[model samples]
Target: MRRLLAICVGIFTATVAWAGMPNVTFPSIDGGTLDMADWSGRPVLVVNTASRCAFTDQYEALQDLYDTYRDAGLVVLAVPSNDFRQELGSAEEVREFCEMTYGIDMPMTDITAVTGAKAHPLYRHVKSETGFVPRWNFNKILFAPDGSVVDTWGSKTTPMSRPLRDAIEAALSGD
Candidate 1:
């Protein structure tokens, strides 16, 4: 009886398999959390976005990328930000614009800062570990299933670019 109880306790106490990354949660645009841990064991393409920038059109390709890879366990997360003074005035305007103009259905966060002292923990951690930060709106960060930074790119790197796609593919395949 003692051995059986110990075995059960050990099994219950075992850590999660996807324990590589720290817990990071974003305020969801849909009025809840967009927790990174929830998508553990999946690759996440996170883009710091804005509604009024020239690169705003990249939102379309982002949606397309998500549509293409979602079924394969890829998660595309849009993080709308006003750090560059280009995002819409509020989350409402941002959501309305993204849905009306781009028909985006991917997960999105409420307006959040992506750089500097007030930058979200996601950016801060990325910078500290990988020395990468959003140079401008639409910057992308690819996180592997283990929560490690797989790759990063600036505003000019479109979501559907070959290199970005390759990185996503590699991450998705656990390579």
Candidate 2:
């Protein structure tokens, strides 16, 4: 009985430590705090974005996807990052440009770190779990409804890709 109790306790502690997804806190482009914990119970697409990158046009498609599926448990977050010397502006400027040009209504977070030694906690978790970083702007990380890492897509993968759609469907259906 003593051995069984100890084993159960160990399992419980490990589970608690590893349960759900890793937590992250970033700032909104407007200087407000953005907490990943608030996204609990929702599947999210975390994308590293830049204003001047070649793939910056993906923002339109991403916004389209978000508009299409957001009512169905999809939450797309655009995180502007200058990690690659791409976005060379302040958060407010990036937010204004994206909103004015693309009409992006999804969550627009501050310029979070996405690579090298200063990667944000979310990006660190993504790179460690998925074995890849945002090689360039517009890399996407899809979180499962249960907050686990579901898939990571490179810049080449369009927001409308079938695999992304299918993965999101699977995550939603599982909920």
Candidate 3:
């Protein structure tokens, strides 16, 4: 009986786990709603960023990638998560810093937890599916056009790395 119960629980857990990606609704930093569904059929590059983190310079590279790929079905969304330490200012402040410091014109979303007990819903999927996190800062998650996680890159991986750019190109091709 004990073995049977354990097997049943395992099967049930697997069923729930494989159901589908959870729908996530987050407020854009610009005070707008951004539903994950809207990004369907478009490859997405999600990054956890901070205004004061040492890796902040990646913003410029990220913006460059976005500018290059925006016409190719690539959407780079920066999510300012302060889960590590309070390294970012208000949403408005982040916007100003990104715009002035790096000239970042890509889409940016509200600051939220990317790890720990309070990790946001999208991050929960990112961490579980990709087995990675912001770790420090500037960790990236690349999702296919079908909303499936394709790959993850750490802070050490520059945004313009050949592998990343190629992945984005492949995802754009959706092939």
In lDDT terms, which candidate is top? 1
> Tens digits of per-residue lDDT for model 3 on 1-175?
9999999987755443311464466678889876767777789998989888778889999999999999988989998988767456689989888998999888888887888888887787766776666777888888887788888888899999999998999999976
Q: Among these predicted structures, which one has the highest TM-score? A: 1
Clashing pairs for predicted structure model 1, backbone only: none
Against the correct fold, how does model 3 do in TM-score? 0.84
Q: Candidate 2: list runs displaced more than 4 Å.
A: 1-23
Clashing pairs in 2: none
lDDT per residue, candidate 1, 50-97, as tens digits? 998999999999999999999999999999999999988889989999
What residue runs in model 3 are displaced by over 4 Å at the alpha carbon? 1-19
The lDDT for every candidate, in the order shown, is 0.90, 0.83, 0.82
Write the number of the candidate with greater lDDT, choosing between 1 and 3: 1
Task: Show where candidate 1 strays beyond 4 Å.
Answer: 1-21
Candidate 1 structure, TM-score to reference: 0.90
